[model samples]
Structures are given as structure tokens and as C-alpha cells.
Target: MSFLDATIVNVALRTLAADLRTSLDAIQWVVTAYLLAVAAVIPISGWAARRFGARRTFVAAVVLFTVASALCALAQSSGQLIAFRALQGIGGGLIMPVGQIILARAAGPARLPRVMAVVGVPVVLAPVFGPFAGGVLLDWAQWQWIFLINLPVGAAAALASLRLLSRDEPQASAPLDLPGLVSVCVSMVALTYGLGEMGRDPSATAVLALVAGVSLLGVFVAHSLRAAHPLFDIRLYRDQVFRAASLSSFLLSMGMYAGMVLMPLFFQSVHDTDDLTTAALLVPSSAGAAIATQLSGRATERFGGGRTVFYGALLGVAGGVPFVLIGANTPYPVIATAMLISGAGAGLSVMPAMTTAFRALSPDQIGHAAPQLNMVQRLGGSIATAVLVAVLQNGMDSHEPTQAGTMSAFTVTFGWVLGAAVLAAWTALVLARAQRREPPRVDAPAPAPQSRA
Candidate 1:
């Protein structure tokens, strides 16, 4: 339900604007507000979990999310819906990350890869199922049902969590790093909102917001350097593996989301498929990804990060070829095959990247790094979506009414996606070399607990 909510509203945005009697630009805030809230609050998840305990935090987040969903259903205006969505995001941001942290903590090093693979399946599937589900609900039921559906699932998850979750007492004397937290939150919120606004209108206000956001982020970097207990310790960047992993993650998401936003349009307009058919055709991508995740996780454990990433990137680029070459009459089987291959590549790449990032950090740092990586991935997705949409819109506007022109535009946009894939591949090569250079560590007892800073 949480994952579904992330992208489900996207396809419904136009309908929502008309129903709410709002302009397209104003209605965008509904999506932006939720994303901004999620990005802003994600940084504090580990701190909250450690301070209150994971089970307690998880349960509270579920309750909060459920309540927020109800509020969304009851919203009478765009502003109200946006506000409720933001409220929902606050809870939603914590759910997956906290669950990841718990799994990481419980699984230990030897079995961590397998656990991550299992967790990754739902993560990938969420976006795939979200749009399809939303389209179905919107076709048959009122738009409000989108939010209403979460109630039952959230309630069940909450109750299951109470039974399945282990209770741990809160940590003593953990520093909150309020200054660092405030600075980062301000920076992320400003940046996210500014970018979102720019997607609708690159006006003076939007430009100023973008500038302010960048400046705030600069301040955050400086604050982290000086603060005694920073929200995310800057020193972690010194780990070559972590740096490679995080950057690869950001770039991979950039490519993946850019393709996602573009492909649906291609399917609908170029192939003349209906919305449901387009959605259904895209399922192979997620299905392939889900299947490959487990295999990639195991491969990463045995073969190491470099080889896994290199092979995955190769597949990603190969998979992208069909989209680049797509014409007006491209076959559905070909499209589905390309999507599956792309998804397989994603599955192969992402788990290794995540595991590599987390493994490079200390257990205490895992909390911080997990959220930071999540933030980067979200930011990358947002930026990629905005840029690609702009390109597509421009292409559609300028091109003459011909099949060739339309295909040309798609080709040009996909060229950018291809560049992203190559970049990921190059980064994978660098990571491989770095991994080769690192000294091997003997399996040893786990380190003692360190308080959050």
C-alpha cells in the first residue's frame, strides 16, 4: 500500500485537477508535497527508531499513515488533499527504511544478501502495481477510493507488526544532532519543492526557490563538518565502497525512472495501446526485476560487487536498445521483452549497490546511510522524471505531424537514457577496481553498539 501510493496518483493527476477545480500547476503540489515530506523526514528515521525502538516506531508510523489516508479520503480541496498526503508521506517514509534496518540488524553478515533480495521484491513491484491499481480503481470507483484502500491493509500490517516485531528498549544518551537535522531538512525540503515547482513553471519564484535550496544544502554541508554529532557523518564518504555504491544508486535511478516515465507515453501514443494494456505490458519489467533480485544478491555475495554491476550494466544497456529503436508499429512482444531485460538488469544492479553501501559502513552508520541513499534515489528519480517529461513535451510541441518526427523525438530522449546507463556501467567498473584494491577482512565478531550521533 505504501509503495503503491508513491506513484499511483501520477496517472490520476489530470483527472484530479479537473475534479478539484484547480489548475494543472497548482494540482502538482499534491504530488510534490508528498515527495517533499518523505524526503525531508527520511533522514530522522533511524534516530527515531533508536530513540524509541523499531517496533514502537514502526507501529506508530503505520497508525499515522492510516490516519493520514483517512484524512486524504475526506479532503474537500486540493490544498487539503495535499496536506493530508504530506502527512501520509511522513509515515510512509519511515516504513521501508526501518524495516530494512531491522532486517539488516537481525540477518547478520552471512545471510544479509538473501534477506535484502526478499525485501527488494516488494520495493520494485510497488511502482509497477501502483499505476495499474490506480487506473483500475479510478475507472470503476471514485478517486477517493485510492486512499480508502489503504485502511484495511494498514490496519492488518499494524496488527501483524505487533505480533511479529521484537521489542527493544530505547538507547540511552543518543545525541539528536538537532542543528544538523534542521539544516538538512530545510535543504532537502527547499530543494525538492523548488525542483517540483520548476517542473510546472520555470518562473522567477521557482528560480529563487531553487537558488535558496542549493544555498541551504551548502549550509548543511558546512554544518555537518562543524557539528559534534552530525545527522549524517561526512566522514563516511571516505569509504570508497560507500561512495561508489551511493553514486551508482543515484545514477541507476535516474536512468530507470527516466525510462519509466517515457515508455508509457511511447506505448500509449506510438503503439496505440490503451492505458491498461500499456500498464499490463510493463509488468515484465517488474517481474523480471523481482526474479533477478535474488540471483543478483547471491551473485554479489559470491562473485563480488564489481562483476555483478558490470554484468548488470551490460544487460541494462542491451535492454534499452529496443526503446531507442522503437517505431510506430513496434510489436508488443518486443516491448515486453525489452522491459523484462531492463528490469532484470535493475534487479541485478540495485541489490549489490545497496548491500555494498551498507556493508562498507559500520552498523551505526547503516541507519544514517540507508536514509541518505533513499533520499538520493528519490531526488534522482524526481529530477530524471522532470527532465525527461520536459524533453518529451518539447519534442511533441515542436515536431511536425509525422511518424518519423515522433520517432525522432523518442530516439533523442532515449539517447539521454542510454548515456545514464553507460555512466552506471562506468561507475560499476570503478567500483570493481576499488573492491579489488581493498584488503580482505577475516570474519570476526560483530562490533559493540555505538550510540547515534
Candidate 2:
């Protein structure tokens, strides 16, 4: 739900502006607000699970998100909608990480690869499908349906979480580190919003926010290393496998999401396709990712995550090759085929890296570890989108408006995407080498505990 929401509303932004009688600039904030809220709140998700217990935190998050969705659907003004989206983001942020923490503890290391693969389905598929889903909603119904659509899914999830999720004791009732929390939250919000601004408009404000964010992040890191109870454990990065997986997750997210942005734009700007048509063009990619996800777990189990991720990253790099040469007359079938390969690469790479990160850590380490991994992935996508969008925009602005010239811009953007994928592959190769030395520790099976969530 969190991931889906991240991209779904994009298709509705224009409609939202028309309906609410607001400028596109204002309506865009509806997206930015949710994104910033998600990023800002993520740093505290570990502490949330620790304080409130994972099950409670997860359920409450689902409920909050669900309620916020209803409010967004009913919102009468742009300000109200943006506020509701931000409210919704708080829930979106917590639901995934806290749920992962619960599942990680339940699965244990021996079974983590397979179990977390199940968890990773949304990570890869959401971006691919989000625009498609939004286009469907708009074609069939009003814009409100986009927000209203979350009602059933969120309700079912909350109810199921209540009944199926096992309850666990809170790790600590200690007070949240006010200093660390503020520093990280402010840093994330500033950093993400700044990144968003960089793509939308490269103003001095964006530069200032980025500088402030980076500076504060440095402060938070220094504080975390010294504080008695840091918001998240910086020490987790010391583990070589965990470190490598985290880096792989970050890089893969950058390429994968930026490509998602590029795809719709390529089809629309270059091919003059409409929303529905572009959505349809993305189907093969979605299908490939779906098929690959089913196999990723077993692949991780058989080959280890580093090998699986490295191989997957290679597939992604192969997939993007065709796009570099895309022209006005480039065949649709070829583009579709390339999308499939890249989607499969994303499916094969993303979940395994996340699972691998979790697999490297002990159960007790999950609370601190999950948020950091999640943060890096989110921030990576945000930063990459900013950078790639800037590159594509500049390339287009400088080129002639002809089809050939526009295609040139796309090719340059795709080169950057390929570079990111190659970098991810390198990181995964490092992980593969490291695992050979200190192999992923598989814990002995432990008895399941009986409890009500």
C-alpha cells in the first residue's frame, strides 16, 4: 500500500488540480507531502515497533492509513488533500518496516530468503503497476476513486493483521531519543523535499535544503555512534554482508525507479501516447517482474542473494541496452521485450538484497536494521529520480524538438540508468565475495511461540 501510493496518485495529479481549481504546482505537493512524510517518519519506525510492539504498531498504521485515505477522498480543498496525504504517509511509512520486523523475527534466518521474497513482491511491482492502476481508476471512475480504492485493501489488511499476526513484547519502553529523532526526521524531510525540488526546479532553496539535510545527517550519525539509545543502530553497517546488501538495495532502487519515470515519459513524449496506452505498454514489464518474483526466493536459497542480485543486476543492464538506441521508429515489441528483461532483473534483485540484509543480522538486530535498509532504499529512489529527471529535462531542453532529437535525450538518460545498474552489480559482486569468507549464518530451527497479536 505504501509503495503503491507512492506512484499511483501521479496519474491523478492533473485531474486533482482541475477538480480542486488549483495550479499544477500546488497539486504536485499532494505527492511531495506524502513522500516527505513517509521519509521523515521512517527513521522512527524502529523506535515505534520497539515502544508499541510490532503488531500493534502495524495494525494501528494500517488503520491510520485507511482512515486518511477516506479523508483524502472526501477532501474539498487542495490544502486539505495534501494534509490528508501527509497524514496517510505516516501510516504508509510504518506499515512496511514494522511488518517486516515482525516477519523477520518470525521467519528466522534459515527461512528468511523465501519468506522475505513474499514481502518483496510489492517493492518491485508497485512502481510498474501504480501508474497503470491510476490510469484504470481515472478511465473508469472519478479521481476520488483513487483514494477510495484503498478502503477495501486497507480494511482487509488491518483485519487480517489483527487476527493472523502474532503479538510480540515491546523491546523497550524507553523514551525516544529526542535529539536523534529530531535530527534524523528533519534531515530526511529536508533532504527528500530538496531532492524533489531539484527535479521540479533547481533553485537555491533546493541547494540550501540539501546542504542542511546533509549537515544534520552528519550530526545524527555522530550522535547515534555516541548516544546510549540511538534512533537506529549505525553499527549495523559494520557487518560486511549487511553493508553490501544495503548498498545493493540503494543502487538498485535508484536505477529501477528512475527507469519507471523514464518509461512513461518516453512513451508519452516520444511516441505521443496517452496515459492508458502508456500504461498498457508497461504490462510486459509488470508481467516479467511478477514471474521473476515467484522464482527469486528459490534462487536466493540456491545461489545466495549476492549471486542472485549480481545476476539480476546484469539482466537489468542488458534490458536497458535497447533503450539507449531507441528512436522514433523503434519497434514496440523490442521496447516491451526490454521492459520484461529489466522488470525481471528488478524482481530478481530487490527482494533478495533486502532478505540478504535481514539474513545477515540476528533477530534482535531486526528492529534497528529494517529502518536503515528501508531508509536507504527510499532515499536512493528519491535522489535518483531527481538526478535522472534533471538529466533528461536538460538533454531535452538543449536538443531540437524533433523526434530524433528527443530520442537523443532519452538515450543519454538511459545511459545513466545503465551506469547505476552496473554500479549495483559491482556492489552485489562485492557481497558475493564477502559471503564466501563469512558465509550467511543459518540459525537452527526454533520452536514457535503461541501468542495473540
Candidates in order have lDDT scores of: 0.73, 0.80
Residues 23-67 of candidate 1 have per-residue lDDT tens digits of 544665666567667766677777887888878988999899999
RMSD in Å for candidate 1, one decimal?
Answer: 3.3
lDDT of 1 at 334: 86
lDDT of 2 by residue, 1-453 (tens): 888988787656557777999754456667667766776677777677777788999999999999999999999999999999989998998887777666556565566667767887888898889979987888888888888999999999999999998888877555677898788878877886677677557899989999999999999999989888777788879999999999999999987777666787778778877667777888888988998888999998899878999889899889988878767897899989999999999999998887777667765676567667777887677667656766677777779988888899889989988888889989989988887777775662211111111
Question: What residue pairs clash in candidate 1, if any at all?
Answer: none
Can you tell me which runs of candidate 1 are displaced by over 4 Å?
Answer: 17-32, 76-78, 193-206, 269-273, 397-412, 439-453
Model 2, backbone clash pairs (residues 3+ apart or across chains), number: 1
TM-score of each: 0.88, 0.88
lDDT of 1 at 245: 77
**Candidate that scores best on lDDT:** 2
